[model samples]
Target: MNSEGGKVVCVTGASGYVASWIVKLLLLRGYTVRATVRNPSDTAKTEHLLALEGAKERLKVFKADLLEEFSFEQAIQGCDAVFHTASPVKFTVMDPQTELIDPAVKGTIDVLDTCRKISSVKRVILTSSMAAVLIRQPPLEPNDVVDETFFSDPSVCIESKLWYQLSKTLAENVAWQFAKDNGMDMVVINPGYIIGPLLLPTLNLSVEIIVDMVKGKNPLNCRYYRFVDVRDVALAHVKALESPSANGRYIISGQSVTINHIKETMRELFPDLCIDDMNGEGLMDGINCTMCVDKVKNLGVEFTPLKSSLRDTIISLKEKCLL
Candidate 1:
């Protein structure tokens, strides 16, 4: 786990919004990286990774699937650590279990199982979300200070049909139990709504929300939203892997603001664009909660400002002609 030398590591879902950033940072840090993607031959999905600074000599892309048993064996075979960042993030699906829940929960198990069999693998950093820690049966009190100690209630999530939250909650829970039973060294990062520059031409859910708003569409149903920079989240994963003192889950969030606050900022930054006003009551209209990041800060993580993050997002969108 030392920060020195060119240690070999594997990153799952390497072409994703956040995972791509993780891969870039890892390569810059001089680590020999084995990146796994569903289809390595797809240039559109992998060109960004293949063009990184040290990619030609230090990066290798492997083909893997979440549901297929032992599919990650080749990618994780000789790595010193694994970063499991692959998961289904759809909001609407005909079959929640088959589309969202099964892939997330089963995907996590398959990655960990591969790591367990690899004698050279020493640690794992799993990417979870605040959705797993924020949702509850009875909504949190207005004064509640949420942290890693809080967990989303499965019964409540299922009753409300919050399949995305339920999937994250279940997947993270399963990972902890598996790690404990098998005596594995593991760390989990629960990040908020991630936003920043895009590495790929395609849009992700978070960035797509911003694009929708810029085009005069109101996509969010919640009154309060949390934000974090994708770079900060990626740095936290590397820090967690290198620091031996790190343990348990860390909540990585930069800020929590009202929907109106975000809209105002967007308006100021992009005066030329026509941004729509959100109408009707929101899902979190009156619920007030705070996410504490003291744990992540302890690992030497400094978050990017909200305004700066949003400004960079718009610029990246424009560069890709998405705005």
Candidate 2:
């Protein structure tokens, strides 16, 4: 194990699919990690985290709720760095404001506020989604190449009822403002659709899409699909924290392909699995945009190939009996 010189860090939403990987990587890199989950008593949510290598000696699980103010204080205190990955991710909800926006915006502010109070905390790495970069007003052109400069338009999100996208955009916006106002060192990682092996027994929304597709269910409605491995996303967070020069927002994406391309690749890899195509019914049939990963690559992240990611995802699902 490469010693981090007794560096201690805090990761909020530690039980989550992406955050779980982050905790595992941090622990493996010899960093003492304080992982905060909603319920430490819930074995289902925390067992995987506890089971990771080096977890017993270097990992501590704390209970934290996003909506509860000052709940993250104890978990973040005395930490050298903080990774704020806790956010509400509901694509469709009856009350978008209460179910999505409130938790996302309030939870970010609460975490940052706690970090600001702690003098030991030097840097913060926030996990924002591609949703904040993809959806925009007037819509992106087919030839548009999206980079860190692009941001999802709030007006378009509100008018189109893109609640999840709006929540991430608003939360990230608030985080930047709060950090600048308080002179905090903050780096944001905007990852594409996160897919790969599951550390938790449960399935996240991104992995669930692949599982649904394998079961002959068509869950994809977008013409363009962008994906990155969960492990890569986790590594990006660590890299952002370790690299002193890492600043601003970095877009971490692996592959950009079409729905048909995904279907073909799956069929080629797992011919036995019953995978169905969308039959050219995608919402944005002809519209396509590229996600620029040049910024993240500069962080020394060699992205895991999408084919390998898809294969491992299927293998993991089969092992978990979710396929």
Candidate 3:
């Protein structure tokens, strides 16, 4: 272990889709991780994390709840950094308030509450989404490419019935306000539609897009969206932690492609899959991606290419027998 180089850090939701990769990289980089999960004894939920390289020597797991105040205090005690990545992610739930908004917004406040009590903590890295920054509805012009400065209009999100995006926007808004008011050192990584090799066997909404594509779902190839690789997203979190200048929000993304473009790549890679291609010429007024990634690039983080991200996602799904 690089004890001199490593710092003890706490990661909330360590078994999560993106958080798993963050914990893996932290362990790989010699950082001792204090990981929090809903149920520590659930082997199926934590086995992938336990199998990582330095987990035995340096990783510790604890139970914490997003709603319970001070639930993270024990796990965060004495840690140098905290990565608060826990949030409920159901979009089609019967109750958006209980399933999405409360968890997203209130959970952030709960974590910040813990941070305020932990004097040993120096910096916090938040896993925010592009939804916090980009307006989903579009008659977007080419110049609509956004950066950290852009914030999605919460009203617009609600008007469009995009509960998930609104949840993220509100949650991130709370985080930024709390951080500023309390003088907390924080950085936000707003990633595009995240997709890559998931460490956990559980399905992620982003990876579901890949599965839908492989199964030749027509709607999957009917629109355009921006995407970033999960591996790149993980590295960005580490970079934000280590880089002194990485203070504000940074957008991490790779090239944006139409769904048709993605389907073409999938067709070439998995020739046996039944797939159809559409030009998607008029799809949402050519809104490939309404964001820019130059800010994150300035931090020396390179995103994985779109093709590679898709290919890896497919391979992972096949390995799990999900495709």
Candidate 4:
């Protein structure tokens, strides 16, 4: 084992969908990861993670809650950097502030506040969704590719039922403000629709949508989204932490494709299964996803294509008997 190489890294929401990938990558790279989950006693929730390649020696699980105060300090202890990926994601809401905004904003603040007291923490890698940036933009004329420089205007955000988008935007905004005031080194990763292998037998809500479609779950047959591999997003987090120049926000998305494309790809791969339930044109037409990825590429991070991601996910589902 490389003694000097073991830079302690803490990942919040370590058992969640995207965070799981982040934790897996950290452990694979020999980083001693302090992973936070709501209930550490629930061995069943994290057994899959504990069974990963190096979980026994390199991974440590901490009990932490987003709504609770000072619950993250012990997890942050002795860590060189923290990847704050825990925040409630909800698209529809009766009260936006309570359901979406508060937790998102408060969770970030709580983590940063804890980090403030930890002198060992030099950087924080935050997971902010592309929804945070794209939701605020007005309707794109045509093929308008947005970049890190563009931000979602809050005014436009209120009109749509994009509560989750607002949550991510508000939370990320707080993170930037807090980092500026506290002199914390922070980098934000804004990823498009995350798709990749499941670390657990049961799928998270995000992945469940795709799995549902594969299982012929959605009847509306909507198919519009540019997908990014969760693994690639995970790598971006690690790279952003390691790269000194990788500060500020970086958009990490793979090939842009419509929902029809996803259905067709899956249908082609799994013809033995039901392909009739998928509506090829149920998705909105002419949605723009020209989110410039040059910023992340500059850090030498490569993204897996959406097609390959779909294939990998299908195989994983089959292996787990979910298919």
Candidate 5:
């Protein structure tokens, strides 16, 4: 229990890259946090949370799973806010339903059910992705900005064999519907290509873009993505929670960029590394993603610069011997 009567914040998937940072910031801000993880008994996994700044006094870890309905009840009980950052983010899916859709949708159902069961949850911040919004008829014209009003077409994504984006779309759509029916206070933070420092040695698919470039796997940037640091995404979650006027959805992405922009900058910074082709920008590919973050910006959130975010990511990978 928090002695200062600070808000009791609940963060699902506390061991994850983004959620871990959310938990850290919550504790550092004097909030008592009930962190839910799949396996609390696993010392290897829970140790990182336990080692956080105020974990011993303010942070509590509970075992919860997305598949297990009502499993989040214990952590969410009497909590003022819930940060639902738990989602299945996999690039390679052998079975889309069992691997991607089931976990993403079912877990959301489970978490929202817990929220319905608990009256103390005043605000629920959902970690949705641009994957849920980026699917569209491509031949994408520049300045066609995507914001809260746009949603990715599930049928189109499924037809195109993009299982990950489809899953995100379905999952987020279901969450919004559930919240609307339940008359719950909810806000969704949709981030794009989240990349940042690693709390664990495990590599996230989002950060792999930077990792592969640093490792000489990707010689040049062929595609561009709207990039945002994991830390900035975490802060956006907090800002959404704290702002009373915040409602509906907010896009949490930075300026559009490609890996080559990062490569050339890294090459300039660390001349020793074998990073070359500092001037090549490959076929201008993917959706000409133009995302607007005015809503989240209205909540007083400023994003980290792309170059600094990538630099920190590379340095962290090197420190962990992952590069």
Candidate 6:
């Protein structure tokens, strides 16, 4: 790991929408990034990142899988920082523990184990989800927002079919526990519904929801919930990496609004657009559900307005022919 100028930082799931943005921002800032993808041979998955600004000299792609041990060592070798952003997120899995929990928890441990053996690795930035924090506590404290101190009890997070929340909560808890047990330096970023264009057309679980909503494929009969821009989420990841004082967890979300909030915003912003109204459950087009961003803002993150995010998302979908 290079602690001096232009330290190399490893980003897991480098081809993912959020991780790709993190890679992009790192390259723009002149930091060397070692990006890991499951398949190095898939040029389609990584070409956008290579074409990004400053990517030629600043980015390197490594083939790594979350299912394998020692796979991340080569990618993280000689890097001062690590960003673990790879996790499986699905609404319904026949076996939640196997399909979601195993990789989420085990992959984190594997990466940390690699870091423990490498003295050069000094810090770890984990990309968790707000579902790990907000889904459990029904009556959220109006004034007291979720911070690093808050956690979603896995046992109580079964209201939604999205078992991915349970996996994330468990994985984050394991990260903290491992950090404490091994005396490793680590920080976690729990972002709300992330919305933005992908570096590539491929979808990771987080961005897939927004894409599906725009495409009128939302199966969840829910009301609205908080959302954040992928750009802001990427910025937060890099910020957490550089800020020495940033330790523990930070909630990163855009403005709060329900499904209706998104629909109305899009309707006003782009009158020609035909956005479908999903008759979902919790945050259906009728309610207002949002989150407080004091934590990440304190770390110097600026969130994009929800309207802008929705507009950009539609544009992205159109460009990708997903619309």
lDDT values of the candidates? 0.90, 0.88, 0.83, 0.81, 0.83, 0.80
Candidate 6 ranges beyond 4 A from true positions: 1-4, 137-144, 158-162, 211-219, 277-290
Better of 2 and 5 by TM-score: 2
Model 4 poorest 10 in a row by lDDT:
278-287
For model 3, name the residue pairs that clash: none
Colliding residue pairs in candidate 5: none
Candidate 1 lDDT over 1-47, as tens digits, reads: 76467899999999999999999999999899999999999998799
Task: Give me the runs in candidate 4 sitting further than 4 Å from their true place.
Answer: 1-3, 93-95, 215-223, 277-283
For model 2, which pairs clash?
Answer: none
Per-residue lDDT of model 4, residues 1-323, tens digit only: 12256899899988887888888888888889899999988876688789888999999999998888999999999989999999987665788888778888898999999998999988999999887777645576447888897777666777776678778888888899999998889999998777788887676666666777776555224445667888888889989988878889999876656666778888887788675554444455544556689999998788776778888888887788876
lDDT of 6 by residue, 98-136 (tens): 899899999999999999999998899999988788655
Residue-level lDDT tens digits of model 3 in 88-191: 77668777788899988888999887888889888999998877877655535676777788888888888878788889999999999999999999999898
| Preferred candidate (lDDT higher): 3 or 6 | 3
Candidate 4 TM-score, C-alpha based: 0.92
In terms of lDDT, the best-performing candidate is 1
Point out where model 1 deviates above 4 Å: 278-283
Global local distance difference test of model 1 = 0.90
Question: What tens-digit string does per-residue lDDT give for candidate 5 at 1-323?
Answer: 12257889899988888988888888888999999989999876688889999999999999999888888999999999899988888878899999999989999988998898888888899988888887876534677877889988898898899998998999899999999999989999888878888875677788877767766655224566667899888888888887788899988888866666667788876788776454344455666657778888888888888778878888888898777
Worst 10 residues of 2 by lDDT: 278-287
Task: Choose 2 or 6, whichever is better by TM-score.
Answer: 2
- The order of the candidates by TM-score, greatest first, is 1, 2, 5, 3, 4, 6
